[model samples]
Target: MMLRQPCSWRMIIRTVTVIGLAIVTACASAPTRFYTLGTDAQPRITSSTASPSFRIEVRPVKVPTAVARSQLVVQINAAQVQVLEDDRWASSLPDEIRDALIARVNQQAGAPGAGTVAHGEDVPVYQIAVDVQRFESWPGSHVLIDVVWTVRTSADVETLTCHSAVREPVSDGYQALVGGHRRAIGVVAAQIAKVVRASAASATDSPLRFTGAAGKAAKGISCPHAADGAQAAADSAIAPLEE
Candidate 1:
């Protein structure tokens, strides 16, 4: 039998280096994924020969500082969170939310055009402002969104403020988590649409009314759904950092 020679330290080091390089190359070559809040669902608004009643302008959205990054931040536990480097939003978090809200609210409210003055110049324009108070993501658990939204006339003569909190359950995937958040945003959009429709109807009946100090409060306006009601059930269906 021939005697076998032991591998030298230099050779072993070279082999280890090659393996490490290969691993690094593989990781570097891995494709990153981008997600958006926009859904594939068809717009609920149907074609109508009648002119649109009003228009909407969705203002820039405001999101919490904790989740302002492009990367998808997920809750690992109560005390910690994980930022997935390979997964990212197609746009900034605020932009994504605002875009989604604009699309869904237009669909729900049946607003023919958004942010357009070319036509319907005589129609009323409602400016929608949204401030996201809480945006939480928890993998294998649920996603929650708490938003304080306001709708005001173009002249700022009347304003109505409302709040919505939506929670959606998800399974154990990033896509599912994102879908949950998307549905939550849809719920918020629906609530805004309800208020918009009500406001428009009221405006047609009589002069827009305001309650409370400074004529900023809306009378008899509530969230579209209750905390534990059919709307919540229909929407049914997360964070770290104590949010």
Candidate 2:
């Protein structure tokens, strides 16, 4: 004769039910925040005039020997990257911006005809070198991109030197930086294209042969430019590449 158990089957069933309910409640109450980014945020404008026919090569922006070697040079701080205090981050901006610029240029100037170099070729007629100086979010809620750039021949010879600065307001939040970056990149692409076109036109009309003046001047000059603070846009939307 065994003694009867105090707990009934119904009690055990109820206990299990309560435990399951608690687990479900906790999951439902938990926060599920999500982050997203856009492909193109800032506005883009193409020059009304025809884009330069010349194929220009763009190199990654680098810190010049003069500035890097100088003790007076100010370095980018880590806090600036994480918080995006300004739109200036070392190397990151150039890498990302360069990619975006390439996309925009390709879009603006449709695919090449026969006899053109393959896409993403290293060899190009004109070469562009950029120095970032003041890339940051400004007091007016605008992202300012200041770049000192020079154009040269394919052999890294100098042609012309010019400076350009663009200030675009940040309309979207963290999710839109990718798009925002693309928009900013479009501006840079257009500006560089214009400069290249002008230089090419000048060379054509000049009494003195081009003899690669573009490459020489660009090589000799070293200028400091701007970069932006770092902020990751996790959900960036990209448009499909056109055929």
Candidate 3:
């Protein structure tokens, strides 16, 4: 006859096995994926051709509390929202936007560089401020962004305030939504570059102050002008070949 096992030992062993299986199942079912809102900035400029006179002071981005967390926000409806557990931003949304803007403005615009506020930092000739009022996505539908930005300089009495709403279509996947947002940001970056180029044209000290954006559409720094027309409701492509 074999020695009998204690009931308590068997129960504990069974419980431990159940917990291990549960852990494995959960891990298998919900693997986390990280994403960022970065894309090839539109209207890119080669290093040799870069032309802008003003150095823009990029202020810290302002994001509302509603969508400030790391998780991806999905608007199920006007009254409801879903925060995905497995799909998330690689960094805080505001920080991601700030980094994206800093990198893109430097590459796509004529600015020498961009920087945050530092001790004893010299005053900047031109300044850029962005407020992200709304950023959300409907996974099966679209990614939407509503942002207002202000451009200020030492010379102008009135700042140029502009609002942009970008809606990019996406398939029924969080990855697609991420792609949409990246392209949407690229579009916004292009707009800011347009304005900065204009300001450079109006300056006196910087060498690029007299240079203009090289095209019919690029009428530099004409503030007190109206905003651009509404963008398409569903544009998924980020770095389009046409640009």
Judged by TM-score, which candidate is best? 1
For 76-170, candidate 2 gives per-residue lDDT tens digits of 34233333333333334445555555554433333233246554565346666778676553232446566776666554333556566766666
How well does each candidate superpose onto the true structure, as a TM-score? 0.80, 0.48, 0.72
What lDDT is reached at residue 32 by model 3?
88
lDDT of 1 by residue, 106-160 (tens): 7667677545445536877888999999899999999999898888877555567
Evaluated at residue 218, the lDDT of candidate 2 is 25
In candidate 3, what are the lDDT values of residues 120-196, reduced to their tens digit? 45444767789999898888899988888777665544566677777878998888988888767766766776666
Task: Name the best candidate (by lDDT).
Answer: 1
Full candidate order by TM-score, most accurate first: 1, 3, 2
Please give the distance, in angstroms, between residue 45's alpha carbon in candidate 3 and its true position after superposition: 1.3
For model 2, the stretches where C-alpha displacement exceeds 4 angstroms are 1-53, 63-92, 106-115, 118-124, 138-140, 202-243
Q: What clash pairs does model 1 have?
A: none
